[model samples]
Structure formats: structure tokens, C-alpha cells
Target: MSDNITSNNPSLEDVIAEAVRSGLALVHTSLPGVVVSYDSSTQLAMVQPIVRFRRRSTSTGSLETYIPPPIPNVPVVWPAAAGGALTLGMVPGDQGQLMWAERSTDEWRKTGAADCDPRDTRRHDYGDAVFVPGGRGADDPLPADAYHATATVLYGATDVLLGDSTATDKVALEPDVQGQLDALAAVFNAWIVVPNDGGGALKAALGVLTAGGWPTITGATKVKAK
Candidate 1:
């Protein structure tokens, strides 16, 4: 029997349930290396293992430098069974911007005292470092130490399992899934990065999704093994 389902019709939960069942078959056939598991309540398919990125830092001058801190190990989770895609939500500090300074000398002549040229100096910003404003909350207008950014890539077999056939169908679904993942990642990032202020953007996004007929996955009962 075919497990394909439409995103607009049979609710997200139903779609995900069917997709998880169908996804196992696809995973078995196409990507044998990846291990697949599911979380019933959250409707999340926990793809086994995690991915990591290398971190490095650079120094521009004595007091100024670029420190690219280590990015944490990320877990890949499918947002929803049907309409959503996998997301590796990473809250990376020091990846966004860099700050630096340079020194310059200026000459001055004294009126009477031995005609001295005072070696005056000034600091300058250079390269991408100039883009980052110094001090806390100085460059980023959001009044937070960190901001949320996301990277999304499509899940090919999952799209096909969701009834995406043509090139256009597959392409069309990519952005939609990517947008949803981005929204969720933003919310997760906000919760971690800006804990002081209430997450207004994340709340608003949830409100919009709730209003738009998106249902929340609540319990393990909803999950089924393929």
C-alpha cells in the first residue's frame, strides 16, 4: 500500500504517522547508513548520531581579535512527520561577527619647547571586523548577546514519500519545509540566546502556526513503529 499523503488534508499527526512508516522503507532502501527512530509525542523522527563543525579564532591586533568559539554538537530532528523537515538548530556564538583595531601615528609641532613632533596615535577598524560594533549590544540592535540564524537543507526521500513527484513538486516543498524549520530554529535559539526578554518573535510565530491549523504532537501514544 502507498503511504503518500497530502499536507493540506489529513492533519499533520496522521501525515507524520504514515510518513514515519513510509520513511523506514525509504531509509532502508536508499540510505542504509542512517539509523531512524521516532518520538511519538513530539512527532519527531530522531535521526541517529549528530553532526559537528570545526571552530577557529583569529587576532587582528594587541587588544582586538576574532574569536570563533566552538559550535556545540547538534542533533537532527524532524519537526513534523509530513510537512516539516529535519533541522540542526545550532546556537553559535562568535560566528556572527568579529571586532578589531589598528593604530596610526600623527605628528605635532610644539610652539616653543624644542619644536617637538608628538607621535599621536589613533585606532581604526578594518575588514569584516568593522561591521561588528564594539561593546555589548552596541552592534546588534536587538539588545541581545546573540541572534538566531538557521541553515536548512531538503530531505529528498521524505519529500517523495509526501507525494512530491515532479521536479516542481519537490522544489516547491523544499522552501515550505525549510521555512518551518527556520521558524522553529529561531524559536529555540531565542529561548537560549535571549533569556532575559520574553521571546516575542517565537511566540508570534507559534501563534500564527496555531491559528493556521497546525496541531501540536502531545503524547507517545501517537507514535507508531514502522
Candidate 2:
């Protein structure tokens, strides 16, 4: 009877393997994706999964084809804590990772409540995905800075905003520093007396120093800081 069962169900192991694969396919988790679109105001994105799902081709049963659907209304993850948040400019075509919530996020997403119950019973659904930017491939590596290396926060290809300041102040960088220095130099240059003038040497020197509106630090308008 045992021999007959073994002969009759020779593909039992294959059936079990297929069942495991099918079960794993139902589990929604994290995967690399590309940004289709992002709304900065809402902090939500539409992402297309980079990794494709393999399915048997309808035309050819022996061949497998790839399927990648774009996920809509996914929240973009920002670095936030203690009342401060760091946001990135995620444009279309930017690479990222999509991580799905363990439970339904519909209630929490709408209310932003700490103790909200799931509106739906769906667990690990793709609709609850959150996008985290900067998931780059090995081919598309981050360029290292000469001085700061990988520690630098880069804006575009050239500009870099280094430090942050209090709400009232800004951490001035680059051309602003040069402009301030130039203004200071102008003030100092004015104090050099030219030996003879209509007034005394002291008065002439003082007049030159105050020629440019009391030697104020003027115009450094294009200053941007983190």
C-alpha cells in the first residue's frame, strides 16, 4: 500500500514547493522602487516597484514574464523627531524602497493618532506602502566629496548647504562670507588717509570711513542654509 501511494503521488514534493512559493508571494514587504511622482505638500508618492513579479506567460507556458505595477498614494518617509523634520526633494525617476505596514494604515494615516485602530483587516497590503528615498543601485553610486567625503549633504551637483541654525539665525555659507569680507575690507580701506585734505587728517580719515553710510555690512542676499 505504501509503495502504491509513492508511485501514485510522485510529485507530492513539487506540490509542497509550489504551495510555499504561492504563500510567500502573498506577503507584502519591502522592495526597491522608482518614484513615478511625488507631492511635496502631502508628502506622498506614486512608486513603481523595480523588482518585477515573475509569472508564466499566457502565450508560452514554458516562459515567464515580468509584471510591475505602480503603487499609488504611498507616504514618503522623512527623518523627523522632537518637532523637527528633514525632508528631501524626491522627483520623478528617483530610486527608493517601498515598505508596507504590518497592519492597515488607513485609520492612522487619516487621523495621525497614536492609538488608532486599523480601519481595514488587511495585513501587509501594498496600499499601506511607505517610500524611503535614496535606494541606489551599485551602478549608480554616490559621489564622494574631496574634503567631507560621504558625510556631506549635497544639493544638486555643485551647491551644498552645510550647517543649520536657530529659528532666528541662519548658517551663512560661501559667497555671503566673501561678501561680508569685502564689505569689511572696504571699511578698512577708507580709513587710510591721503596726507592732505580740506579738513584735518583725523577729520579726513573719519569722513572716508563714514562715506559709505557709516560702514554697515550690506547685501549678502543669496544666503541659504540648512
Candidate 3:
């Protein structure tokens, strides 16, 4: 008699349960991954899945260990619509989530067609994975100095451009601007511009009375970017 259960077997429910488990294992959804490398030009990344695949071996009744190979050329997700996009600088060792599309994305990726059909009947394929970067461990929290109560904050780089990428006007640093204004005010206060038509001697300069001195123009302490 064969050990494998058939449709006429007494324990039919056991076969059905095992079949469901095997099918569910093949369905790829989402998993945590670490970025191995990123290509900004192509907006693609090489990601190493963080989860280890485990399955019980029938021969020895032991769990088999399998680490998924690094996935390459995975598209990185960015917030975009219409003609505008917000792109981020993804780097190595960045932790993120990997999501597999419902169908094969080969045709869609290659042609950028909205109504394109899958090249094959593959579903929830690992090859169609896209990365969403920004996930971090709870123990490794963001720096306290970078946190803001209400306003949007940008850390690391400070110099900012408000217009197009090629725009020449860059926002000046607050401290630098303040220093320049202070210097100009000092020079103006000292200069004794006496319009002389053969004057005898220079008198005290006409004082430009300010409320106190140069008003302090403080810059945004919370938000900054480059």
C-alpha cells in the first residue's frame, strides 16, 4: 500500500490542510529587506531580504534553512503624480519593506503602459518586487535634535533652493545673513559723510536714531534643507 494519501484515504481533511499550507507558502506578499545598493539614475535598488525561509523537511522532520538571494533592479517607490515627484537619496544598509505586484510587471516596466497585460500568468511574483525605504528599528530612533512639534523639518543639509533645479537663487543661511547685516549697520553708524564746501573741521555726524540698534532677524530654527 502507498504511504501518500489519496482521495479515498480515511484522513481526507489532513490532505486538504497540507495542500492549503503548501499553496500559501508559494504566495509572495511583502517582507522586510535591506538595501544593498541604489542606482539613483534608474531609481532601482539591490535589496537583501531580511526574513529567512523555513520549512519542515519530510525526510528528517527538521526545519530547513534557506536565505533568499539578493533581489536586484527592484524599483524604489517615490511619492509622485502627474509631472512632479519627491525623490529621496537611498543608501546601502537602509531597511525597508518589499512589496510584490499581483502580476508580472515586465511589460509594464518596459513600456510604461497603463493597460498592459502580464507577460505570463505569474501572480504575486518576487521578481515584481518594489522597495519602500524609511523603515527603522524602534530601538534605533531618530535623533532628538531633529524632532519638531508642528513644522516640517529637514536635517543633515541646510542650503535650500525654492525654485527649479537649475535655479540660481539659493536661500542664504540665517547666521551668515545676520552677520552681513550687522557689519553693514556698523559701517553706516561710523561713516561721517560730511558734505564739505571748504568746511573748517568735521562736526559730530548726524546720528540716524534707531529704536535701539539693528533689529535681530532670526531665521527658522526648526526647518532647513538643501
> How well is each residue in 49-155 modelled by candidate 2, as lDDT tens digits?
99977654556543354766899999998898776777665789999889989999999999998899886898888788999998999998776533364575444
- Report the backbone clash tally of model 1: 1
User: For model 3, where is the 10-residue window of minimal lDDT?
Assistant: 200-209
lDDT of 1 by residue, 1-226 (tens): 2234434467777777776754442221111112234333433232221122122223421222232222121122334355655332222131122222243212211242435444544344121111111122345354332344564423222222233212222223445566666766765665543465577666776777668654433322211222
In what order do the candidates fall by TM-score, top score first?
3, 2, 1
Mark the regions of model 1 whose C-alpha exceeds 4 Å error after superposition. Answer: 1-172, 192-208, 212-226
**Best of the candidates, TM-score:** 3
Q: How many residue-pair clashes does candidate 3 contain?
A: 0
Candidates, ranked, lDDT: 3, 2, 1
If scored against the real structure, what TM-score would every candidate get? 0.15, 0.70, 0.72
- Name the weakest run of 10 consecutive residues (lDDT summed) in model 2: 1-10
Q: Looking at candidate 1, what is the lDDT of residue 205? A: 62
How far does residue 194 in candidate 2 sit from its true spot (Å)? Answer: 13
